[model samples]
Target: MERSPSAQADLRGGVIWIALGAGIAVLSWRMDRLEHMHVNPYTVPGLVPGLLGAGLVVLGALLAWRTIHGGALARVAAPVGVDRIGDFRVVATGALCILYATLLIGHLPFWLATTIFVFVFTAAFDYKERRTAGTLARGLVVALIAAAATAAAVSLVFEDLFLVRLP
Candidate 1:
């Protein structure tokens, strides 16, 4: 008979996701077919993304329907103590990722850009545990190694194994 604020929030998010997924699927359908290149019909450039978008739409619709069926909006609209700082951190992380993808990827070497991105992300997130004097060095070393390893693994997978081109 009652629901929490979180349920209402999830309902709202599900609607947004549904709309986004539909838009993506539509755009994907409208993309160029590259018929001139004699590409295989099954291997169309938008095939995977379009399918993903459809999947999202279905999943989001299911989520919204589930929330509604659960009577998410039936409860009183009580104020939930929102984590503004955590939200800010999430937004900042997204911005950093966008920067890494758009500005860094094409301009710099793939390995170097990926390494820097991974290292900075790791260090920034782990700052609290690394604040102490004794563990600081160890933390930094670990982060550096992790970053390098991640970069190498990614490079090997995309460049060598998948034969995908990297900028």
Candidate 2:
């Protein structure tokens, strides 16, 4: 009658995903419809985001349902520490996102802002592992390459391919 840690974790994760997805969906729906631009109906700015949010909602619901059907709530088990992404990581990630969106995006060239954000974020989260392995320098190099590539790719897709202006 007791569920394992994985089951409990799944349930919690599913709920979190559901909540996050719903938030995204609502925000996406509220995004400007570009009525003035008279853009193609299919190219509405929020279409992709709304679809992504809907998918997330569906997947999260499935995860929650599966966990419940598997007897996660049959009986409560003693709380055990779940080795999930720690609270600090979550907070740091949120802070970095806010900084990138607010300070980096509009103030700097899109590519430059993205490059800096990605590099800093990657280096910050990856340093501890690299330090233990005595590869901090290599990690930094890798992070730089990754950041550049990410920026280039995003810029190309959004600006060139999608023809969307970047702030």
Candidate 3:
């Protein structure tokens, strides 16, 4: 018997979700194990990742069940369009931002690094309206405030609270 298109799409989505979930679980487990070298033994860094991984695993199981029992095979058979330009731009920008942060962290100081990063990242998404000077002014003000707040929070957490030095 032929299955419906929606059913097939659901099955495909289920498979994709399951695969992603498995990947996340594996990475989370690895991260949890690696974070054990921190000063406090009782302070488990892996807890967050472990919980997230478990949640993903449960979600994957539910998706798989729905795909199997809800007749989703037909939906998975549909043809889909690919948009490579947007995907490439997103990946490239993300990589550039990561590289920028790593290289600038120690050299530029936290406040400068963070301010520049926030401005560049926010502007990159075209969030700043060019026609409205007020909008741009507001965006810059907000970015500066946020950057300062982030720096303060980091300083408080690492320096004052944990007595750890920032790089």
Candidate that scores best on lDDT? 2
The CA lDDT of each predicted structure is 0.88, 0.91, 0.66
* Candidate with maximal TM-score: 1
Weakest 10 consecutive residues of candidate 2 by summed lDDT: 78-87
Error of 1 at 118 (Å): 0.4
**By lDDT: ranked, best first:** 2, 1, 3
- Name the better of 1 and 2 by TM-score: 1
Off by over 4 Å in 3: 1-80, 126-134
Report the C-alpha lDDT of model 3 over 76-159, residue by residue, as the tens digit.
Answer: 454445456666777969876886668878888766676677666665554536425557666766766776777777777888
* Superposed model 2: Cα runs more than 4 Å off: 1-85
Clashing pairs in 1: none
Better of 1 and 2 by lDDT: 2
Give the worst 10-residue stretch by lDDT in candidate 3.
73-82
